[model samples]
Target chain A: MVLAAESQLRLDANWIDYLLVAFYFAFVLGIGIMARRSVSSSIDFFLSGRSLPAWVTGLAFISANLGAVEITGMSANGADYGYPTFHYFWVGAVPAMLFLGIVMMPFYYGSKVRSVPEFMNRRFGPTAHLVNAISFAVAQLLIAGINLYLLASIVEILLGWPLWVSLIVAAAVVLTYTALGGLSAAIYNEVLQFFIIVAALLPLTLVGLHKVGGWDGFTDKVAQGPGGEEQLSSWPGTALAGFDSELLSVIGIVFGLGFVLSFGYWTTNFVEVQRAMASSSMSAAQRSPIIGAFPKMFVPFIVIVPGMIAAISVQEIVEFKETGQGSVEYNQSILYLMRDLLPNGMLGLAIAGLLASFMAGMAANISAFNTVFSYDLWQTYVVKEREDDYYTGVGRVATVAATVIAIGTATFAASYSNVMDYLQTLFGFFNAPLFATFILGMFWKRMTPTAGWTGLVAGTAAAVTVWVLSEDVTGTIAIGGQGGAFVAAGAAFVVDVLVSVLVTVVTAPKPESELRGLVWSLTPRKDFHDPDEQELAWYQKPTILAGIALVMVVGLNVLFA
Target chain B: MAERKHEAGAFDIRVFIGSLLGIYGVILLLTGLFGTSDADLAKSDGLNVNLWTGIALLVSAALFVVWSRLRPVVVPDDPDEG
Candidate 1:
């Protein structure tokens, strides 16, 4: 989060580049202007009226997270930890996404639930739903603020404007498109942003590779870099995990990151899920995440490779990392490479990409924030049985309100220059517990609502306790190599399971009849995927698509290793 | 199979995305052929990156345009899904 604003690009774009950026923005606003016609109902405003095809929703799904924060953060990880950063994508994200599409989307899309919290209400009852909705709403706002801060900082660097001025300008762009066409505008722009991001970054990676001679030369330089041979392998990622034993490090990456945190974010978070939820059909809904997995897996080549190249080639970063100069931060690896490698015309496209990404991320956050606020919070609690058009009006107003609140949040994010570690630890405390409750409640019909209530509160408390014990909060103990957050995640998962199991034994579970489609064992086999309803090709099936994604990701891991 | 959404002709996302890419590709391709300098090529280590990438973009743009043209988006008759 902090990294988004940490390192300014020092752009040397010429008139041609500026012209290119102008063209890009014109397209962005044009999409919004056109999409506004499609906005006729609350469903249109909130979920694109549930009409987008699998590919559009799919690209939007990845584009939402393919923000500047992710690009910069993952690149920094590559520069600092080298090949091990691959674990974040391959080990952490792909499996969880597959699980969602194959196992979870049936329950999510088959039912009339439009949001994750709405689904929670049907399963665990109202109490758990309120907690999930409120926490999720608050989380998106804070994250949007962070995205806004990053966007404003980039705009400030580009135009030489003041921070507040840049902040409003940045906020206004997102607000306009979002307010105009609603999710349709945002999702269409996201799909375009996805292509622009790839167009901009792929060349940088290729050019940087050529500068280092080739793939072999790049690997050799990494092996000889600060982290030594460990920097070249994906396994035994001791440097990345902050674990002493190799086994512990692998466990941290697989379980803490892969199972708990990944599932927490991808399957449960409304921002990513909202994209899939907008799909045209149940089959399309499931394919959204699976389609995204293909592009998601290969993104590291363009993002991380540039960072790795920067670590070895860029003098400022090399000195800053080898010493504590702070001359050039590791997170600025992409920016520095853009400066050293790209010329005027290409430079502008990359700059446009950075802007596109920041807006895409904030749009995702703002759009999701408005959805959860309107559907789960306001409509559920305050107002009932209102006309559908009134809620569309409410959603539009929420979009504006979220943008305004996000500006305030962005100010908060800007003030805390180096608090990202602590904020991430705090996030783990929120996410890990929710995932625990969700997975437990979904699988075991015996898990009671009383258990859900206790387990969520207890799990979060346990995670916070671990954070306080670790150096991330108090300087009493030293937890290194990003291990503290992993430990906190692990603690949350374990405590939630322990508490839920205990409470379930004492309390009465929901009746079997009521838990039919929501619980795994209770759902009929045909309910998972209704082959009788649609005559689909073998290639169109979610299982075949997801299976191919899994195999390709594993192949990438092996090839890179 | 997923039920198809009726994207009104002018508002098809693929058409817009294709048009945007076509515009960029034409601009880049023109600049690569006419405006590219020796110094610019030297920066990217002797490859005419603009020219190559422009051609790639143009090819992709053609594909997107042809895709939408070949099989246009079909909207359901009663588009009242909420």
Candidate 2:
């Protein structure tokens, strides 16, 4: 708990602070309520009538991608890693855009499908769809809960309020906005919140930077800490750094993280895809990803700067090594910096920004959760009578159900670990398996439904086995560490694919007509055309330009290194 | 499949590069000029405000250069529209 001065801020946490928070929530809810009139059908409710302008969709796209956990987590990582972590955004996500735009987007957008799972069904089968959908939904729930839990915990820490009170209050605000708005409401609020987040963070960073001697002083200070010089300056020293990994691995991570991740995200992640479905045209949907990419490029600045500053401010860190207190918790660095540096009003603004960050993440998860549940699960299974009104109304109910589940799960998440770690672990668990399924389904023609489904279930099971076995087993035998889960899940996916492919070949091929319908979604194309013509068109000069860009970026980085 | 023809004439590569140069050039220059002296830049007192501001300038300049060079293509509006 904060001592007197911080405690006083909470006691004196006037109606004005409440009013500011309330107004933000109200604005989000207002957009949703207003949009409700336009949502006369399931597509309209889930997607927003497919009439969003490019800029609006773009802003929302970025907003949804950023959540409170991202803000807090990035800030924490920056504090630990210094400027190299920023490369994760630039080096990590940018090339991804190129790959996604040039390679994956053509196929995904070509599909004209509502969900990634639906596409899986086309390529693989119903089994693949069911496995992907369930895993995705489970992952979404875990992530949403973690995001909300973190938001609440951060608010309490800043305000010196009770944790449960903070959790309930924050949950209520997010639920109100999301419940009222759906995707349209969430995206609009995200844009508004994005600005607020930037405004709050930029000034606070300046102040924190000022408190430190600036960037050089900050880096120098961090350089002096135990192993600080080596640790602060270098990359993750893992395969992800692209140094030790094979060329294929490096290319794969870059392509997988950037292109595959983005394509998969935009195409599959219900939260983001809802924006595309809601857009006014096919072009608008395409533009949304491009628009969203702008902020993604800059997001590192928001999360990384404070963490870097905190590293410099180590003297004030009250090193818990002596007191059993400050043992370098990765996520708390940003919040700690704010508490130590900012005065009252600035602190309040920072808290608000933090909440905004958390809400953005939670809001995306919630919005997407409603989508998957409504479109894939509820509409498909429960309702044979699926009218537009019926599905739309069911979407609202699912939104509520999602919110309630998130709140309950978040309480448990907060009790165990900080929001960022919990989120990353969960993300790795779900994303690793699903990523393999989608990648194979898109690229390989022979990937049967049995293969897709087997890959998903087996991949998840492998990840779980690692999770379980890691506790008792010694080094090589156990997979119970940070990087282990990804390795496990990834291995499982490969195994599943191998088994499923064997089964598929041994069985029989589906009819050409059935294959034709799916070929559009699975293969690359400008429109629903023959796969052969599409493949030919995909070649030509664009590949040359893309190849040039890749060489230039790598060549420049290598030369500079 | 819809075929897109790339008309090099339609691109403004020069302007893009020019803008990138102007922005990043300013950032690089500012940090180099106004950022902290090399003596204090290495010390652990705190953020060398001048240094960070300088680095920020350098980064912004680099970003500008990259952005300008890779001009985003805008689709031409249909002339056949009634």
Candidate 3:
């Protein structure tokens, strides 16, 4: 009764907290105003005119992906499953991020394509490009809706406002910044948000760890908690995988999560890739994701560790962990900690940090969507031969349109939250197939355009089929848990490679001459290297940084495991 | 060969980060020093969290602002003006 009485839906934020949040909003809008002076062309509007330095693009690169889902969802995963939740970072993200920086970025940056889908247009012609563009646009809208929905929910909880008011205000803030300054506004705000997020999370983790008697005491308590000692270790990750067989779980992790899903999403998702593309130079672009990998690897200490501590310290999380019978959602792990631990000033900073993250995420999606819509969809198909200024205007218009549609989708999400699970599985079918098609088309110059589109279609179909046939997150025909999505991704990749090979054999190949910069083997050495690369210090080079990141990640795995 | 493209007079991201962090840092530092009560310290497991975190934020904010001041970005000559 005492615990239940204390467990209210609202956080204890005072006027100072409100003041802090208002200051953050003013700065966010101010950044948009500052960014507006730079938007002279479509490229400026859509890609920051490719003028941002590596550190800016790099931090923005990771921040774009660290939405509400990351802070809340990862913490939720930690509360529910324990250390195995970290596998999402180590196995599911880091390596692929490194591979993207060291290997794939050169081709993308070298081609001088305005967007990722634009690269597809030049290589496999319009059909493949159209497929990628539409799917990417739809996916961004849906995901942005989820982010906006969560952002509104947080605002409602924080301010005690109605959901409708919160929704409009959140959407309006994102719309104003994105439509005003375009990607420049989004990227700059994202960099600021990234630091704010760290400031918000670090205090919670440090204070939580201290409360739980530091790392050693926390580990000991977790070993004795509701989930038992199995929660302490990371490998095999049977609890995280939702698989009974140890072999199946390990295989599901290494190949399914590590190889397929990781590569598919990190390498292909345009929202994250757009940040790297906005870098001032190819060297900056190549260095962007690599720079991001440094922070990406360590963020779990702040996010997931707090969740683990919450499982022991917070009554709601502890009760939910003990008996799955409470009204507590796992995502509330951070909020509960804030309510219980953070004083008024820190509380405001934490609230502002959450707002910044949600806005950063939605802004990334909106900006990426507008670029693809204005360039790949509108200019190529809807209208033609217009001035570059006209397209810049179109991008702004698209930004408004995308935010409005996302608000609609957010309402739908509010009503049918379960629909989000279904849609995520449905869209999870996208990245793996696209990755399969890209890796195949890039390395194998003999791949025809027909093969390109066909492979994409078949791979996505294969993932969908596997999801349908399986017990749908319970692992009857296929693996389940978070690992279930991994199996679906693996299935999509295998089927795509097989279909592309067969289709390429029968269809006429694109002539090698046309494959020049598009295909890896056909691309010149200059295409892969920045002309000024040698002049930079060793640490600034992508390859060296990627190597360092790889070793550090491996060392972290050993230390934690 | 493609010429190395450079633009001048654009917004510098470092200055933006530096200023924002500076503002948040100073306010949090002030709150920690003056407004923090014993109840606040008790909730935070007996540590002066606001004070410590405020100090940390101020330090980092100083670093960011100094870095930007030392290396502020400037746009090259506008070809249109040329």
Candidate 4:
């Protein structure tokens, strides 16, 4: 009631706040300029010259994925749905990251492929490679556009700036640095952005918790609200029991999100893996995602807890919950809290962090886009004998083109109410069945190139059909929202696996000699670690670190449950 | 090889960024602790979010600095060894 009576929230940014944000932008651009000299070759531009240590690459790896959506949307989910949102991190991300580090990094890193599509080229031949490259390039462009739209909207709301102003400013800053420095620049800024984000959000959480009288008081207050105990409990009920209006079955969350989507994104998505591949050594490459897992586990506190706080503290959020009216302005949850809580200079730092996150996300997508376009598409199809500088030039040109395309896409994405949800649905269509192709291709020497193409095409078709059908279809079989996405992805994965196996059996397999280092069974059994890594303490070992991360993930699940 | 080592030890951006944040964080933390008026406290719901947040940022900066110190980039003798 008190919250309802209160007027609309407005950001009270002072000169200090503006100064802090300006400093952040200046620092990021400075880092880009500083990193420019390091990127002499296409390899350096695309892969950080493959020289960064695990820690740098590791933080950047996670930060690449921590876009504006992760900060804003996850918290919005927290305010609306509560603890189940943590599943995105714990089940949906951590295990898959560990899988990438321990099992799959050998193929990705050991084989010396520049991009994910390049890896497909080696395993599945030219057709599959082309298909993957085109789809990924298109997807990255859409994502960049959506991120631009979301960030512009947030900036407009928070700073009372026009949408076009934020869009151009963001695009200009991102394009200047990204084109100049390449992946190394993008990565360095991502690491910097990560720190800025942690710096910004940690205080918001602490202050929020303090305001609501700590965790117990916050929980009690949320329990008294509209959603009640369901919102507080991480495991709200059985798999069949619905949370609010959404049907999130255990099968859907575990199989669909945890298995298909997570594996597809973490293991195959070049944007995330490019960071790991940039590591200085094979050992560092293996350890990078593992190192990332530690911080990835704790991200929910900064992103999600703020939303939980707003659920009880803000009336607009409560009213949205009660009326079930026009879609919950869940995306505004973080900005709302900052406006309500942080002081002038601190508010600037927080906004800078938010801006940093948006830029990092866009930069990651753009850099990946450029690399995939240059290496996978241009090198393979356009001209094979061009100088390295020529490819690098193409990469720069692609970066500029990609940014323009993303800006155009952002204009289109403006029509979408929930950009984050729309993006996830888009990912479900593209990335869900990709894991099946990757998994079967890597593990099964029997899997043919034709099978790979067939599986991918058929799997994507299955996912798309389900999504389309879900709109008109209803009743026991009807899949909708996140649950629908999970089911659709699961179905696609199953279809992909079955089709690949069947096709592989029917068609002749690639020779074992040719498959060496590309397929798991045919590849040599070389140790993943270097001599120096072998000498490190047990806790420092990649396997040990990943194990620890897994245990921590399990512990968090139990604690939250 | 010597050039590589020099590159490794060269101005680490992480450390530079960390040090900057640490310095700024200290300033903000001190301001939050000592310079806050009653009106400022009222605006923030009686909790010094800035003070707490600044402390957290400082700690984060310290962690980044320490991580860089402990695992200073190691360039292999053979550039291809990685």
Candidate 5:
């Protein structure tokens, strides 16, 4: 059985392939070296001195979200769940990204806040800042660690490389660039990675299409295969019919993943928002995510289609079934496609793209971790009155420390059965409540500092309780996997809102003068309109572009359905 | 502020990386198209993923270059100043 599986999935490469991979590494390292001189201060280190244009920041913003695990897992999910997997990108991502660009960027970019936790401090108080900053810092570390572990696993699987070597090399590369040049290095490399990933996947999609004939032929082949037709449907009847009874219903997707998780992640997660916040101007900041949305909407084609193709083509599933392994290794779907479908030179380039994405993801998390640690924690607590250079040094040190911690965490993560599932559960535990705090703090003038902290704590508690009870004991609660997370997050959001409203009604609110630029009602809106934007044609406007993206998303949903 | 001004005029790294990839990608693509044997093609399940990917990489690189040229990075005066 093992031999059959091994032969079914090829894992051989030659010297020329290694040469191509070496070139890719050299180019990435060169970018980092070139960017080092630009990091003279803390601002440049953390926010790229807020000087990048929309396109640079935009691609980075989207790319920062695209980790190796995300790319591989999405493809795996495509194989497992079919077209419905796109719910993650479309319903789960696009709207929230648009919301961040239109509604949230003004507050984040306009207030000149250094970090999201600082924004929490300004809006709520010191206690709220401490809670948020600590949570965010820890979350980024875990995420970075998991990304490291995932990359190492991919290398081990594909190249027969030892796990430790992959982890060390990835850690070293990420640490060198992020610690040296900071966020600029991270963002620039993300843009380059974005191109590489797209380039790598485009061919896979085309080859898969040509092999299966065309879109119609592809769909027909999948439908003719075992459980293929059902998988091809983007909307599997009603929400209840589509998901497992224990997982999300239609209502759960709309409210839980869409409203709570999506909004929580896209709008508030500092790792993603930092990219948009690095834009040169308010207009650029707003336009950044909008530009990102265009590419984001089409990403399913690159990541998901290949997985769908694998579902029909790969025979590993049958062998696994015959062997009674009791599990289909769906996560290896993309690897199977690569080994069977890509030529020698192309295989090397694809592997390089995979490596680039892993680095880009790790660099993004490390940059965010260092910034939060230095700005929100170290500067706030350890040394309050520090020079600019002192903080910059601290940030660099934090990068190294974070990478070490991540390496350790990656080792720990190796014990988990499924890293992707573990991550979703973690996000539910943290971000759901974090979003609750942000929603109330931003929109509600009557919400007090105590209320903000209380809501966050209570929301996290609710999510954890639900998750624990569901996974360990009764299994009655819908909280084991991603769907369970959505339900738990939704429940947490409700609990948070109830607690916040209850606390706020009794507690005293911050003074209106102090609340300026922090709360929605009290904050005066600044006109973000640029004359340059006006100079462009109407269709080129950010609003118009966002509108078009929304229409396309809807069109895709309908077409797939 | 002076440092900021000097940085604006510094080499656009996006274009540099794009051009580098574009050039190399074109080379790999040409090689994939013209140099491969039937056995080599058979190894890839009869699909020329290399040529297709090379073309895609070149296009992406061109897009990056064009985007950088169209809207060069503009340094905000005293961006760090309150």
Candidate 6:
């Protein structure tokens, strides 16, 4: 109830927090205003005039992926699971990026579509396109709103501000800049936020490490804990004390979670696609994923290592009889660590970085939502024309609208028992289905439009049905008994895939000719050369080297971890 | 020239397959050589060895960069096909 207690006792008088929040909003708004000139056309507004260099694209990609949930949730996950949580970054995400770069990007870029749904239409058919667009939109709403709520909680906690006040402040900052600048504004601000977060976190980790007398002393304290190795480094209760990873769990975490999750994230997540869309040409688009893959390799160090330090500190604190509400909600452990550890001006910067993370997340989502709404929904339905001004204007309007909706939702979510639980639950409801539809639509050329729609609708319905049927969570269909929502969603995906393939075979096949360009972009063509056909630029090699450096940095962490 | 065209396609498959083979080979080698000792060597209290898998990954990733750079550029006949 510390959260509730803390929620009631506000520090609105904290001028430093207010100033930091104000500065963030001012920066965002200034960018929005500055971007107005560049955004005359829809291409400029939505795609940053399709001229973002790979580094900007790469930085924006990482910023969008980090989000508010991840900044807080991964720390929470680390607190709960210790160092193994790093698997989410390394085993799952990075490899997936590599795979995408080597395999998937070529296909997507070769098609040269503006939106992912357009690619679906080009490759599969209208039904596949429409289904994915609808599912993705719904999934984004759930995720964006929930993340906004979680982030608002942190702002509320850090500044001693009220929930509505914090949510409003956060939403206004994101919306102001996003409404003016579109994708360019979002990416530009995100690049700045990425650096600010690193600036805040790196010193925090080093200081915290020093506070605990370096790694040796830290390990000694952890070893003396109640759970021994289990409490300190291993996932909270797992018996894999000395084992690198449990055989089955490693397979699940690495392949199932890593491969499937990473594939789903890179291939389907629209925020990531926003960067790809800004590429000057198809190769840039393809190479963009490769470039972006570089940062993901280092995320574990920036995120998980600090989290590992937190677990040690908290374990030490608890051993000394300081078992309080701070340690109870594992997600807040990082914040609690920061509050107790950080000194003055640095505290201001860290708080600013936290807020910046939230703003970056909200900006990306708002931008992505507006892009999809303007392109896939509004342009598809209310406005048929694809003119620059109309679409760009519509995108801006939708950005403001989504910001409002997310803010309203945040106020409601602030009262929820656990924002992460609620968001993950909602994510299970929709994301699994979107993941299913995208995978099938991309791989199964024999898939029919009818089958695609059926799979998506049925997949979502089944997941919801299972959630409802759980007499504990709700009451409805008794089918499948009580199961985790993700499990149910997974089941639904299997059924949907089976039903889709069966129906597709029974139904008429779309011509393979339609899919050739999108599906087989890697195939060589005679009498064809690319415009940007210089050897993958020299500066571009930094991304490669950065990728190498990131791996080395994390590799060093592993040697020391 | 026609025979070279066929040979190029064959070479493309080799590059793709060879890269894949190399990845598995490296993964297998790392697992075989360090898999057991990494467990004992990383047996520290707060440090987990699987975390070192990230290092092996970092090393393998170097290979990935080299592999990607070395990937046979198809060099389409038209300059704009990319």
Worst 10 residues of 6 chain A by lDDT: A234-243
lDDT of 4 by residue, B15-63 (tens): 7578669866876787688867777777678877668767876887898
Candidate with the larger lDDT of 2 and 5? 5
- Of 1 and 5, the candidate ahead on lDDT is 1
Q: Please write out the lDDT profile of model 1 over residues A366-481, one tens digit for every residue.
A: 88887888888889898977999999889889888889999998888765433234345656778889999989998999999889878988998998888888865584666754
- The alpha-carbon deviation from the true structure for residue A200 of candidate 6, after best TM-score superposition, in angstroms, is 0.7
The sequence of per-residue lDDT tens digits that candidate 2 reaches over residues A1-561 is 322212322323344335445544555555567556545532233332233336556676667767755576667656654554554455644455445445544455566667766777667766777777777787788788878877876767656777677878888877876666665456556665666576557755776666666767666766675436644542342322323444544443344333433333444565665565455444445556555655666666667877767656744343631243543454667776665554333344456667777887887787777777777777666676667998888878877788888888887775542344455445545656676666666655665666667667776676566655653234545332223433444455555556656766765545545654355343334363333443443322334445655665554335322
lDDT (Cα atoms) of all candidates against the true structure:
0.80, 0.56, 0.80, 0.77, 0.75, 0.58
Best by DockQ: 3
Q: DockQ (Cα-based) per candidate?
A: 0.42, 0.04, 0.44, 0.42, 0.41, 0.02
Cα lDDT over the full model 6: 0.58
- List model 1's recovered fraction of native interface contacts, to 2 decimals: 0.30
Per candidate, the number of residue pairs that clash is 1, 34, 3, 1, 1, 13
lDDT of 3 by residue, A1-561 (tens): 212322357898899898889988888888777666445442343333344567777888899889866787788788888888787788878999999988788888888876889889888998889889998998888888878887887887887777778889989977876666455567778888999999999998999988989889999999999888888888778987778888988898888778787778889988888778766678888899999999999999988888888889998779888987676667667888888889989899899998888888888888778888998899999999999999999988888888889989888766532222434364468888898888888898999999888888888888887787676634458555565566778888899899889998999987788888789999888888878889999989888899999999998887768
Candidate 4 residue spans exceeding 4 A from truth:
A1-9, A37-52, A236-248, A326-328, A472-477, A527-534, B1-4, B7-10, B30-35, B55-82
TM-score list, all predictions: 0.92, 0.73, 0.92, 0.91, 0.89, 0.74
Provide all candidates' interface root-mean-square deviations.
3.0, 12.8, 3.6, 3.4, 3.4, 16.6
| Retained true contacts (fraction), each candidate | 0.30, 0.00, 0.46, 0.36, 0.42, 0.00
